[model samples]
Target: MNDDLRRAVRQVLPGVRTDLDALVRIPSVSAAPGSVEQVRRSAEMTARLFKDAGAPDVEILDDIEDGLPAVLARYPAPPGQPTVLLYAHHDVQPAGSPGQWSSPPFEPTERDGRLYGRGAADDKAGIAAHLAALRAYSGRPPVGVTVLVEGEEEIGSPNLGTFLARHKDKLDADVIVLADADNLTTGTPCLTTALRGMAACVVELRALEGGVHSGSYGGGVPDALTALCRLLATLHDEQGNVAVEGLATAVPPGAPVSEAGFRAEAGLLEGVQLLGSGSIAERIWAKPAATVLGIDAPPVATASPTLTPVARAKVGLRVAPGDDALKARKALAGHLRHHTPWGLQVTVVEAEVAQPFVIDARGPAFDAARRAYGEAYGNDVVDIGSGGSIPFVAEFADAYPQAAILIASAGADADSRAHGADESLNLADFERACLAETLLLAELTRSG
Candidate 1:
């Protein structure tokens, strides 16, 4: 059966490649203001793939009041077999600019061994991997299968929890596979065992009543933008560590990553020292980190020499695995306000926050998955951590405590450049991912 599955996956690769290209052509940028239609088209495309794969029930679930579309397809389990839930997302981050990419962002192009386009790695290829695995079995697996491809993951899945509650029966399973996240590197099969949660806020500082000429008000009176910059600088200490109090921080459980490899992977310039302390894995995976997402200051092209009266910035903080996201967000706000320079008027409007999670990947289902991926990749599988947050992961854990959740690095690798310009997927790794999932389903059946 394993050989047959391998042959089947090899045979379906061409079709899968074509489908992936076509799917990548759609600009399903969920974060854009006018992207509803594109997101719907992507969801519809995902639904058609599952329907064609012989799913008994395929639905585009858009019933959530303020939610975008999602594809849910199910095939009932055999009498004694446990069900397996497969997950991915059809939506993607916005492609920044046409100039930032070599080829057109919407046109999927193959160069060397990768396919480049928006959503090619972050999640759209995740959808393709699921489709390929389903097709490899001719749409008839050893156990029951359920596929969930959501439309708003890039936007933090605001409505996912409510939708899951309303449609719990359709999604419940014994083993859940989250086919998102990145591997340790290209050609290395890994399962994400820990993910740092995230919190965000928009902070505004007000000083003078109106803008004044820089020369007229140069020396004595401070500008709002300068004060805002000073406040933002206090988030990190001299050594580049997050100085915010009351946030959880700890070293993660993983093998230490080499400094040279880390520098190359992160694309750091020569002689640029890394910030913070400990191994790269520990700093990124377990410790808290903060970033200024965006500022509402005047652009260089439209700038005038004047003291701006008001300045605002959107701040983002990554919560450690064991920390509470809301608490960390509050602490971040507190630090910003406490360190405000010159007693400037400040307002911290809180934004979305998601709790972190750590997976105990030692059960039978996880064992089976690890073995299957090892066999498929010809390398032993390893445990890794992700700095990015997937809000729905916590929601899934709360909804189904007994299920064994598997977070697979199905499409992304170290150099995929996900959520950035010219994002791409390693083609060879993608094929291995399909084979790994195909083996995983059969392995789950035996374990069950």
Candidate 2:
């Protein structure tokens, strides 16, 4: 039965790619102003596709004020069968700097056996995978299915909790397959068991009331930029581990990813040394990390020989699994305050906070997913951790504590370049993902 389903998915690959192409061409960037209509168009298109795929009930969910649209559809379960919720996002990130892309960001160009576009791999392919799985079943699978494609995942899913709260009964299911993550590597099926939480803030240091001529007050006066730089430097030590106190760092149980593999995956320049201690996977996947996203400083081209009065920097922190993001944010802010140079006045404004997630992958649904992924890829499925934060994952876990949550992806790995230049999806991985989902649904309906 699974073999037949795989063949069926293979036969529908062309149509799936066509639908993905249509989705990739929409330019539905959720972060851009005035792009709400484009987001709505994408959501409507997604609804139409779900309806075409045999979903008896499909609706556009736009309950949040000024929120981008989402699509919801349900295929009722056969008697005594379980329902699975398929989650993906229809909106995409902005196509930045067209000059950096090999082809137009929204053109959906095919080259070197890969599809290139803004949303080609990040998530549009995920929606296409769900569609392909439904098509493989001829729109009526052994198990029930629900599709919930959101429109604002890229912008932190501010309205997702509200939507989920309002429609809890409609979206409840026995299993959930979140296809917004990545495989460990191409052709290697990986189940993401943990994701780090995130916290961010803007730290401002004010030393003087106005800019002063550096030539006149060179050594006597305090420079806010220098003070800010010093405070930021205290975040990391010489070995580059996060130097902040009161943050959690507990490594999850998993096979360590090798240094060579991480180096290749990270695309490090030659002779660049890796930072932090412990295994590469532990440092990245299970520990806190802080990064200075940007600073409010004058460009070198427009520099003036003056001591700036104030300087501000946006600091982003990734909390380890099992850690409290709010606590981490407070710790970071306190660190900045304590390390302020020359008694400079400092202000830290907290921005966003999202808790980390860790799933217990030891139930029937996970067993089914493991078998299905192994069958699809002809390899053993490995458990892994993602450093990136998906706030909605935690929300889903809180809302449906009993439901099995599976974190799988069709496009991950170094070559996918998701959210980067030359973003593309490997056709083989995409096909395997479709087959995996189809087989998972089939497995759910079988006798234990």
Candidate 3:
């Protein structure tokens, strides 16, 4: 059966590539104000693929408040079989600047064994993997199937909770596969067992009423930009670890990421020192990290010889596993306010917060996934942690407490460059993911 499944997926690889390319060309960036129609189109295209794959009741659901449309499809299980839900996002991040990309962001380009484009690896490949799995079974897997392709993940899935609440009964499943995360590396299948939470805010500082001439006021007048920079600098200590008080940090389990692997994966330049203390995994997956996303200051090219009056910065904070996101947000806000320079007036507005996720990988579903992944990739599956946050994972855990949730991925390495320019998918990894999922379904059927 495994050989037959492998052969079936190999036969359909061309069609899968074509579908992925077509989906990638839609420019379905949900965060852009003018891309709603494109998101809808992408959702429609996803529904068409599922419908064509013999899925019954495939529909494009647009009832998610101000959110982009979502595609949902269902294929009932044969008698005594368990139902499985497949989750992936159809929306993608906006292509920041065309010049940063080697090829156009919307046009799918194949080069050096990768298919490059926005959403190529982040999630469109995930959807294609699901389709491939179904195709391997001739659109009728041994176990029941439900595909939920969301369209607002990039923007933090603002409407997912409401959508899930409204459609709880229809979404009931015994197991779920969230294909939005990455594996440890290429060719080594991994199950992500932990994910950090997130907290973010916009902090504004005011030092003067208006800009003043640098020549006239440079000596005595306080500059908001300078104060803001000072405040942001306090977020980290000399060792590059988060210096914020009241935030929790943990020691991650399992093998730590080596320095060489970290440098290679992060694309760090020579002579550049890594930040923080402890093992690489601890610094990334088990500790809080703060980043100043953007500052509302004059650009270098447009700067004038003036003293800035006000400056605002967008700050993102990653919360370690087992930490409360709301508590972390409050701690971050307090830190920003207390660290203000020159006693300048400061305002911290909370933007968003999402709790961390930790899954218990002790069940039949996980056992099946492990064996399937090992067989598909020809390597022992490893347990890993993701520094990124997926808010919906906690939500799904709360909503379906009895269901087994698994974090798997088609894009399993740093080279995927998800959410960045020249985002690409490794075709070989994607094919292996499809085979793994197919085998998992077959294993579940036998176990059930």
**TM-scores of the models, in the given order?**
0.98, 0.97, 0.98
Cα displacement (angstroms), candidate 3, residue 403, comes to: 1.1
In model 1, residue pairs whose N, Cα or C atoms come closer than 3 Å (at least 3 residues apart or on different chains), thus clashing, are none
Give Cα distance to truth, residue 36, candidate 1, Å. Answer: 1.1
Residue 328 displacement (Å), model 1: 0.6
**What's every prediction's RMSD, in angstroms?**
1.1, 1.3, 1.2
Q: lDDT by residue for model 2 over 66-148, one digit each (tens)? A: 88899999999999999999999999989889999999999999898788999999899999999999999989988889999
For candidate 3, the clash count comes to: 0
For 168-264, candidate 3 gives per-residue lDDT tens digits of 9888999999888787778989888889999998999999989999999998988999999999999999989899999998767585687898898
Q: In model 2, what is the error at residue 441, expressed in angstroms?
A: 0.3
* Cα distance off (Å), candidate 1, residue 254: 1.8
Candidate 3 Cα RMSD (Å) = 1.2
**Decoy 1 TM-score against native:** 0.98
| lDDT minimum window of 10 residues, candidate 3 | 249-258
Quote the positional error of residue 191 for candidate 1 in Å: 0.7
Q: Model 2 — TM-score against the truth?
A: 0.97
Candidate lDDT scores, in order, read: 0.90, 0.90, 0.90
